[model samples]
Target: MKDTIKYVGLDVSKEKIAVAIAEEGREEPRYYGLIPHTTEAIKKLLKKLGEPSALRVCYEAGPTGYPLYRLLLSLGVHCDVIAPSLIPKRPGERIKTDRRDSIRLAHLYRAGELTSIYVPTPEDEALRDLVRAREDAKEDELRLNIA
Candidate 1:
């Protein structure tokens, strides 16, 4: 089972995604650069990862929502969406870059320190979207009244 387990960490942004791959006992993790944060890009990434047998993928739950989580599930890759704040911070870690974030995610995941967020389904996502839209519309109305 040790040989079959592969850990992948993704640092996702609106434009690009930084990926890091690590396996148990591997000295250094492999870093992959900016992949577009689109469905097509996600598909391509899963393909590049090869067969997903016993592979675990993790990413921080950011503004991107759960599209990647759902996509990975469809591709048979076990994925975890974790809260960004739940991850442990390194002391004096001033450099907050995507590459470094990805590396840190990989290391933390390997160390079993990541806490996953609850992944919502398609229906749940639709409901959430509706609620958000309604809130936005209400806020707009308030702004208009103030104006």
Candidate 2:
């Protein structure tokens, strides 16, 4: 049998990550539960899910940043940093939870409805971080002088 692709959705946060998987075909996406937000946990999850070549993963872009995306890419997994605001929503569907988000992401991703954002190179990210830090420091200095 030909290998079936698995579209995996991850709801990532500072402490944990919620996971869901949508296998090829029309089956409803299933919640795969939560795991600690760490490299080891992610590697374990990938192993449990099957081959990296068969896994397409995604998560919303958030303050927790692109490290997870980078990690997945390094592991030979196709990963997307989804624009959260652009994720499709049903009318009046406001209830939000990590599990639900993961499931929705997986389903939408499988349907080719989710948009993947451009991920910057590590060097670019470092430069951006440096610029932001400098801006914050300047703001703090101004605020101190005003006090």
Candidate 3:
């Protein structure tokens, strides 16, 4: 049997996520509509995608944080957070939209043109949060001293 891999690309937003799925060696990708950016919506998406072993998912890293990545990892889906700038742009591809972006990502990922960003573990996240909070507290203290 030939190796089959499904590539799922997601354009994540604050309120919703646009998804596209493409099987390796396939020319056309299937588009999944905008889904709410909530835990329930993500779970529903996983259900629709079926077994994790059958798909490899990817999304551009943005302000939404790593919640989706963490959630997908916990559920056994191999997920990657790709840097937006790492995706190649085709010249003369004038129109740009969520659907197009998602489709592009799917294609790039399938072609191995996407480079994934680093995803810190839970411990790393906690440490980073703690450091940021400490920095904010120190800034607040300095402001009070000047006042």
Q: Which has the greatest lDDT?
A: 2
| Pairs with steric clashes in candidate 2 | none
Poorest lDDT segment (10 consecutive residues) of candidate 1: 1-10
| Ten contiguous residues minimizing lDDT sum, candidate 3 | 1-10
lDDT of 1 by residue, 105-125 (tens): 877787789999888888998
Alpha-carbon error at 34 in model 2, in Å?
1.0
* lDDT per residue as tens, model 2, 11-117: 99999999999999999999999999999999999999988999999999999988999899999999999998899999999999999999999999999999989
Give the TM-scores of the predictions, in the order they appear. Answer: 0.82, 0.91, 0.85
Angstrom error at residue 133, model 2: 2.9
Clash counts for the predictions, in order: 0, 0, 0
TM-score of 3: 0.85
> Candidate 2: worst 10 consecutive residues by lDDT?
1-10
Models sorted by TM-score, best on top: 2, 3, 1
Model 1: how far residue 121 lies from native, Å: 1.8
Q: Point to the candidate with the largest TM-score.
A: 2
In the order shown, what is each candidate's alpha-carbon RMSD? 2.7, 1.7, 2.2
For model 3, residues 30-138, the per-residue Cα lDDT tens digits are: 7888999998999888888777877799999989989999999888999999988877877888798899889888888898999999998889989999999999999
Clashes of 3: 0
In model 1, how large is the Cα lDDT of residue 117? 84
Model 2 ranges with Cα > 4 A deviation = 137-147
